[model samples]
Target: MLLVFFLMVAKSVHRIGPTEVGLVTKRFGRKLPDDNPIAFNREAGHQADLLMPGMRMKWWPIFTVTKFPWVQIQAGEIGVVISQVGRSLPIGAKSARYRTEFGTFTDLRGFISGGGEKGVQRPVLPPGSLVPIHPVGFLVITARHVHGLPVAPEFAALARGGKLVAQSFKLDPKQLEVAVIAPHGTTDVIGLVTTLEGEPLPSGDLASRIGAFDDIVALETDRAVTDAQVIDILMGTKNGLHNNYQDFQAFLDAGGRIGLQHDPLLYGAYLLNPFLVRVELVPMLVVNQGQVAVIKSFVGLPTLDTSGEEFKFGSIVAPGHRGIWQEPLRTGKYAINPRIYAAELVPTFILTLNWANAASQAHDLDARLEPIVGKSREGFIFTIDLQVQIHVPDARAPKVISMVGTMKNLVNEVLQSAVGNHFRNTLQALEAVKFIETREQVQQSAHTAVTRYLAGYEIETKGVYIQDVVFPDELVAVLTRREIANQERATYKEQQAAQTARIEMEKARGTADMQAELAAAQVSVDINGNRAQAREAQAGGDAAYTRITGQAEADRVQAIGLAEAKATEALGVARAAGFAAQREAIGEMPTALVAVAGAVAEGKINVVPDILVTGNGSSLDGLAATLMRKLSPAQDGQPG
Candidate 1:
């Protein structure tokens, strides 16, 4: 009893530590206003004035002092203050309206006098703040702990049961710390903000723009504003006014709406009230090389068609309007809120699409495509692997995207039908052999047809190639047999030619073996012919000489014979004349006798017939006698 009396006496001169605040509750004061739980004029209930560090004089039994640890907000942490005592909040307001004089909710008197409401305060205790707030009038909730007295019955019961946590106020423990949008690295990210406490979002809009697109309207009205300039303007943020939702009063003052926010959070730490503002980290819109991002804005000015009447595919608008923008974002990373604006990436480079078994590694647009199968006029089925190269002009990407909705749609729907049907019809019309022979012509025709068809969609056809052809098994077998037969025929012809060549070669070899003997025989024949010719020439010369000599000798002999004949004739004539003279000179008989005697005497006959001419028989004697007489007479006559 004596110690209790000492404690009550010591309480009259209370001492508050440097890190503590003394919350004074007047035990016998006037009743507090019904609308306010705290007393600013020393009424009953909890007193709005806090006892600062050092000392305080509150008479015992008249007032009670309870010491509370000073609201020490740690680094990287914020304290959300809920005011237990103030004027009632206006309907539809989620938090207490804040005033400049409230000054971090440390001055309770100023907060009440400045029309502070009784609820969660608009401005929160920033990081590293050491504030001495009246513990009974306010509760500061942090990530790791909650500080202050529970005012309501349910809250006090929960606190008593150890269930009064940060989640009790619909807040995660980590949310009490500062919200950080980290710097972008390999894949950039952006924070999409969603406000929990603000005016409901306007109808027909998915998100809330702070100024409600008035800036975009002004930009759209300006004739000199370019599409790129409009995108730049839209990227500019109004986070400065609210200091990235750290100052919730400023955000409310600036007409911030609830639900999805148009402006996204860039790279930075923001002390946002978890109960008021929620951030969702999402991937930034990245338009890579060889691509353009066509923006379809859901939050912008009213839609107005910029594409002329000739374009019947879809409506195209300027960048700030609520439709597909004419200009696309070229190869860049954008920190755009995807909920408000949808971006479709359209490739501006040559896009090769294959109608084959394999899908392109660069894109999946042809993943579902397969080789075209068709029957020829001969009922032969054939499979064709084709490749179609198309180009989407950067200037016409928006129109092309609007026409087909996506590149995959262009491949699967439009080009698939155009190319597949054309090839099928073409194959069906042609015989298998004709199609094989005129494959190049078929490719050319397909290219022309595809070019014309894609031109209608404002797309360019770069090339159409027939990559491979898979003929039917029956056709392949027939072709293989025919080719084998042709090869066999060529082999037979070659064998026949080899046999003929072998015959000629054997003949040449036999001739070559007798070459020396043949040469010698030819030389001997030549020698014999030359000798024969020489002999014939010599005989001819001899014959010619003999003929010439014989002719000359014959002529000379004839001349000589003629001359002798003349001479002889003359001599005979002379002799005959002499005989005639002799006969005339003598008488007939006497001339004879004288001639006889002269003949006998000239002949030199021997007169003496000495037994030389003895006649045989009787005639001999008579002839002898005559001869004796003739001899005697001749001798006598010669002498005469």
Candidate 2:
């Protein structure tokens, strides 16, 4: 009765709360009804009532009830078991035996024993019992201990194969404990064992498990290790190894894989391929900065070719790829023999011949090459007696190198064309002074022709000078003849000028002679007029003198006559007076005689005696003589 009462009281206690659910324990034969009053009841008086939070329940002893604590109300408690043997248990087997406070508990003995009223229980066993349980409820059974049980050897072997051996020896199994076993007992092994068993050991735990290179041991597991977890384990093991050989061995032994790195090696000697082959143009004129070098002119004639060849390393091994090689093998990876291989070949001049031909070839080459020569206009060209030096003051060496090929080809082509077409004519025209006028025109024409020929290039055409135009002997002779002709024409012009001067001088002389003759004639006329005037003056003076003398004589004679007459008259009067005085004595007779005497005296004055004296002449001879003497005396004394 007491037992019945105790059972009923035990059943009256109920579980309640948010996480709790009431569990009912009934007799084996009894069937609880679907509509039973206990299903809805919260009071402890029903067979089993769920006591909810804030709800009241009354304990009743009449019906038996038991409050089963809600196992779902607690947090999960996980347990692990490790085996030293190298094997894993079947899935869920280990979890079944794992004693978690909230999880389902396994009845190991119940599984082993046949069904009965009281199937299996934990208790102190007799000393000789085949299986034993530790006093601690949480103690796990391992394969080693299980092998020691009173089972046949075959049965033990089968048990080891089927159950004790790990499902995966290389990794830990899921939800199962792991065990690391080692032949040698060391702290590393201990740590590794602990770690594999899901007991949190220090990092690098598994790496320390491997004893030596040959050491072999079994680890137990039933599940796969996740990739992330495996990586974490490997990293931890690498850190532990850290350049130590023993640690490395331990890592390998613990199923750790190692990794490494390496470098490439170089091979046999060979030259590097040239990266850039530049063809530039050089101009005959001044080369400007950034100007493309190009061909200018060509000289002489020779079979000339301006083509260039380029070889390249193709496909990293073959040759003769041509053009600029941009890529080369890595220096460290490729060995280059500088002496053995010709990495770059620039054919500056290829043709072979005599000096003249060579020179001609060179000139032709220059025509081809000039196109690629880089030039700076800043530099000056210095020309001496026979040589010329082109000074490039501001030349860009790199640009020059780049342009060399192009310049060469241009120079060659230009020289060839120029010499072939214009050389002979230019030489002929340059032979004489007369042709000097046309020389410039010819040179300009040549330059224009050359420029037009090289128009495809980028060089400028500066002034072209004819250094020395060589003429053949025949051309020289022709030039000399022309010069002679010009000289003769000049001489003839000078002679004509001299003749004109002589003609003018002759005309001037003739005019002077005529003027002198006219002057002489006028002088003669003047002299004649002066002589005539003198003769006329002399005649007039003589005539006037004669007339005066004659008039004086006439007057004197007449006066004497008149004086005689008057004197006779006076004498007559005197005689008459005397006579009168006498006449008074003989008057009348004396008058006649006086008159006659006067007349006679007047006549005698004319060298004749007067007739009146004749009358007295008879007596007059004596008287006359006397009279003459007296008259002479008187005439001498008196003024008459």
Candidate 3:
């Protein structure tokens, strides 16, 4: 009896695999009142609760258990949950209702009590997790992860289908620069999105509400997801701070409107759900350093008056208002969506538009303009190449755009036609060849007219230059012949002037030569006069020296004469002294007599003076004779 009972228990046992879940069905239970396929309470049908990976008893022929593999979501993957037996969606409701209080559908009792709508649910299962779903009420489907890399060909195929370039490269602000390398990519690329599944759009609205994560995960899995739906690009306060669709949910929560947005994805990579969003790469709006991007907005608040501001409104708004913006975007990079706002790149730099057949080195904007041609008053046809430089001030860029559309439109629609008409009309009243002679006046007139015309449109004319002029072939031949004759006449006049100059030069040279000879003669006369003056000065100096020497000798002779006379008187006194004293003094007279005789000998006197005779002639004669004899004893030649 024990062995039989163990066999019956073994036969009733059933097992579910580790990677799977089992759904239990109640056997021989009371029938449900509504008789629906699923019973809210345990009835003669599948049970409300699921059996997780384990063995169960009494699950044999009487009660059936269905085994299903747990939903496995890989890294970067998301699983969308769908409830099969929850409350139905209200008739007028847009989608399955979402309420954050229900704890992400993890608690079955809470979900049921919270009246979780029977349909798609919010809050997707994140990457790297397995979810156990009850077969009776819930089903989980694995949503493929979007690959940012190009290993998978889904994006490439979708890109080709939407007529977009499959390849993309990020411009590392430090990488390749546009100023040097120019620009790349198609001119018509755009952000194309096709929402496969989402909340239904409101009445009269082109785009549906921005979906949460669960709605994004519930995108269609097959080919229907690849269809092209133009996506509204993000813009303004939400521009790129949303991190290139990486933080789109936050953008939406921050009052980001749905449908086509005004901000575009710059050149780079993005991971987006294929079913929820599709991108069409569009051309970039490059506002170069010297340009101003005039913005014509199709969305924003009401325009306000700026009648007394630096940026006066001429159908332009202040920075944040609607209508055409007065303050333009200065030089820089901007990711723009063309559908929302039109950006006219008005060059704030010198813009030169050429009216000529030849292309200019400045820019290609004037390549198609034709040379100005008109008939003069004398019915002579002439052609002129004109270059007009214009400028739209940074503050006036939007005004120009409001008046016109773009720089090209301003040139093609307004300036080109106006300038051509003015030249055609004004030149018809001027003389053809004389127009070249007084060309400055024509340029001035052209400039003045154009400036006045452009002032009405808020554009500045910097300058008007007449580049080249082409005359009719026959007119050119006639002009050349007339010019050759005129040049010959000018040459004759110049030759006459040269001859006169040469004659004047010779006259000057002759005068200079005469002055040089006169200077030399004057120098010789000056030398002779200086020599004569030197000789006269020498003679005067010699005569003066002789006169001075003669006076000095006469004065010396006078002094010697006076001294001798005094000595002679003294000798006489001694000789005539009293008898006794005379004898005594006479002895000293001999010494005096010797000194007198010596002086007489030195003087070489031939005769003695009679005045020197004393009282008796004979005695004096005798004394004189004695002195002479004494003096003669010293003579060399005379006999003593």
RMSD values for the candidates in order, in angstroms, are 16.2, 38.3, 24.7
In what order do the candidates fall by TM-score, top score first?
Answer: 1, 3, 2
**Clash total of candidate 1:** 0
Would you list the clashing residue pairs of candidate 1? none
Highest TM-score model number = 1
lDDT of each: 0.85, 0.32, 0.61
lDDT by residue (133-233, candidate 3, tens digit) is: 55445544443321111111332354354432212221122111111112354343335333333344444444322331122233323334421111112
TM-score of 3: 0.55
Write down the lDDT that model 1 would get: 0.85
Question: How displaced is residue 133 in candidate 1, in Å?
Answer: 2.2
Model 2, 1-640: lDDT tens per residue?
Answer: 9998776666565444553333332333244343222222333223332333333333443333333222221111112222111112344222112212212222323322322111011111111222222111112222122211212233345466554332222222322222112223321111111111111223322112222112111110213543233222212223234122212223234443321100001211111100100111111122223232212111111112222233221111111112212221111111111111113222222222111211343333332221111111222111111111121111221122234344343344434445344534443434344344575675577667655643333233444445544443555587789889999999999999999988998988887778877688779878888888888888889889888998999999999999999999997687545644654565544544554456567764333334445454575575666445533423343211
Ranking 1 against 2 by TM-score, winner:
1
